[model samples]
Target: MMISETLNCGAIVTTSQKGKGDLIPRAKGAAKLLRIPYVERKRLSLANLQANHKNKDILIFSQKGPQLFTGEGKAHEFHLSMAQLRLIAYDRGETDHLVEALGPEAISSFLDCTAGLGSDSLVVAYAKRSCKKMVALEGNPLLAYITNYGLRHFVHENDTVTAALRRIQVCAVRFETFLQRAKDDSFDVVYFDPMFEVPVTESPQFLSLRGHLVESGFTEAILREAKRVAKERVIVKERPFSSIFQTMEPDELLGGKYSRVAYGVYKVKG
Candidate 1:
């Protein structure tokens, strides 16, 4: 069944896929468009949803356990969920280089040209250490809505998450529109994670239904636009051996257990 039809706007429900329960949900009217597991059973309510966002209560849906926004604030709440499969990368300590490459001191502002689930943006927010603003651009409405909801609920609790979110701005429009809205080289960094073709793994749940529920492909146009809009650098994440994208090569590569962090520290010539 469609996840939205079973949900109510502003109500909190525990989601179930395949008859399993325990994903947190609020009905922000995107249930049909987004495929989030928002249901309207008796156990769901508005106060619970509010509490989930406020960090005053913990919601454990299914087996995902307790995932608080843990971000710095409103601006930083813009993000993607790090599901079990992706958590493998985080567990092996790959996220640290992303934190190091951007750095705590050198960065002050970020524009996520490809803010999928806002995960990359959230991480950037957490690591910015000194950043005051993060403007995220997402092409998917469903993912955008999910990310926006997350920001509103949980980002205000942690000092780092709140601080980063304080500077967060979201454009629910396409990346090209976002690119047109910005001046050339106006930001300290413009990040990209254009979807790459990867072999289907056992972990389909790790992929958001807002994204392709099935394995899928991303476009070259998105990469081209990312280079054009970024002021300081363009970072692309992909599997090490994929070799399909035609974008600029990284000034350096940050090693990961199963992937390579390809990044270009951009510098425009006068």
Candidate 2:
């Protein structure tokens, strides 16, 4: 079978010549998963790649960690402690819209269909420690690999936070495909936080992620599958008055003042 130009166009996996032996295998595996070539070299100059291959990107493995870089001179890597600040705020009595949307009760399991950066998933894992099984699926392999690495390696001062982060299981697969094979009522709650239809262009953080972000949005078919796999309810996070909400009316809505995120919860019918 011929590989599409798109597969090889933007990215090739590479490892630092001085990269640890243990980390080298992961770099090769990343290349294989993305169906891109793995190049082992002494060093990678992102600036040179930007000038040389206009469309090409690089995922470099080093002793520090795996990082994805676009020729645009920006790098996207997973921060293991990304959710720590959020959790801390919650601990200090901040009302987390996502946690509130899930209700106060402890759920046994969670399935995050669109685990962009795995931020929300980490928060859910921390909040619902009683519900220890948290699985996140990312359609973008690069994002998934980075998140998986962070989850395993990120250390935290708080034992509970560290444990929660470690417990999350991230898989590189399309949510639709994963939902199809999931048994009925496999998880207590299914969550979706797809990329906003209106991108946050003003935010440098989100803008940096633009290159690696998956552009797909949710559809009725996906919602249907999510409902089937969720034993409790399926929750969606989006901005207010999103067109998607009109198409798929949720049974409940949860939001807060000055909050950009809102939730649409569709309870599973017994």
Every candidate's CA RMSD: 10.4, 4.0
**Candidate 2 — number of clashing residue pairs?**
1
Cα distance off (Å), candidate 1, residue 253:
2.4
Q: Estimate the lDDT of model 1.
A: 0.49
Worst lDDT window (10 residues) for model 2? 1-10
What lDDT is reached at residue 112 by model 1?
Answer: 76
Index of the highest-TM-score prediction: 2
TM-score of each: 0.58, 0.88
lDDT (Cα, tens digit) per residue for candidate 1, span 100-194: 55634467778876665566677777656576767887654444555555655454444655555445566555666666666766677777665
lDDT of each structure?
0.49, 0.77
Top candidate (lDDT): 2
Candidate 2 pairs with clashing backbones: 10-57
Q: Residue 60 of candidate 2: its Cα lDDT?
A: 78
